[model samples]
Target: MIPTTDDPIGDNPALIVIDPQQTTSESEEAMSSGAASIPGGRDAVMENINTVVEHARSADIPIIWGKELHRPDFADYGAEIESCEPEHGIVGTRAEQFDPILSIDEDDMEPAEYVIVKRRYNFFHRTDIEHILRTYDIDTVILVGFMTNICVHYTAHGAHEHDYAFRVAEQATAAPSQDLHETGLKCMRYLQPRGIQDITDITARLEEYDGNQLVKRVKESGQITPKTGPV
Candidate 1:
């Protein structure tokens, strides 16, 4: 069973939106094509993520967008893993930019607000993500985005290692295959050990927890402030 946190989520939770780039790989193509042919496909997953994004925005929580991008010359080790580097303009290319379906507005694109250009599966690796979270005093992380088995899984692992209170939006993530998706969820359910809430449940939980009120209540009661610093 997933563990729960006594400190209300509103006390400052960060939303990490991971790897929702374009689809270009064969597996992704198969999934997208199959989804198009079926009643629900790629679009269904994107819509769910968008819904979660809206909820996070309404709650005034920070939304951190992480996209995988590599250098053109494979100067980074990521290119060593594959023959051809992930080019800039190719669809699903790490450099292709955020998926438009996410509906992130111009205001949400502020530099301080989002963590972009993540080259690896784990957002904290060689990135300012940890620093940003520390700067914002965010303790809990709600992870949502694409390719559940790969990037999502890696990020959650990193979060757990860093001792951050972590949550995954189950419905908001998509994998190349249903089996992979289910396996990823099972791994997160066991590995994460805390706050593995469904997208709907998390949305409602965020709405119910008022951050300002919680902060005020904690302060007024003369309670010792829980360390809001990095894990």
Candidate 2:
């Protein structure tokens, strides 16, 4: 179990990658159906994500990749289909899996232990993520991945309600539009001041934690900047 500490990251933290799959717009089906699509420019986002992943791995931090997958019959899909393309994330389809561009290497780490499947936007909703967190005694979670305004945003809420301090990799996530992405970051920052952080900052901190034998804890001064709004 991770030791309790005053530091925001605590003693043990996990990296939570949410829905790192190809956007509907990148697939052939989207061309035919004109379904909802994540905006382009995933290449840049994945580069930052891989950097964070590499550092987290170097620090021996537990990494959990969450992918959105639905039942073959789409029975698990709820009101989301009404808002999004119904065919997305269907079982036995490419959308249901992680994007090939991700840096997840099962040969280097146990695949089963590093991936979680979800049917909804919230990673914790009806998933074993809570159990995994409890097992690892994870006090903080670093969230990064697709649709900054949707899955990433909702998972931040899940982390809050589940009693886990969290951070969002600012440049490692994307949305359908720049405005929406910024809005998502603003919302998360409103939830936790200084929570929307750079991936490099997070990796540097993790490296410090690792080099310090993973036992040292930095006590905070209890200083926090009060936020007026979500900006």
Q: Which candidate is the best by TM-score?
A: 2
lDDT of 1 by residue, 110-225 (tens): 32346567767787777888876775577788888766777788888887777677788777777667777777777887875555666778888778765533334334553325
Clashing pairs in model 2, backbone N/Cα/C closer than 3 A? none
lDDT of 1 at 198: 67
lDDT of each: 0.66, 0.70
lDDT per residue for candidate 2 within 1-231, as digits (tens), equals: 323443535567888988877655545443121111223367677777788887776666667898888887768888887865436677776676567778766456442236788888999899989886775567788888877888899999888887788888777888766677778888988987756777677877877775222212211221122244577
CA displacement after TM-score superposition, residue 54 of candidate 2 (Å): 0.7
Q: Model 1, residue 167: displacement in angstroms?
A: 0.8
Worst 10 residues of 2 by lDDT: 215-224
| Candidate 1 wrong stretches, greater than 4 Å | 1-11, 25-39, 77-95, 106-112, 212-231
Model 1 lowest lDDT segment of ten: 30-39
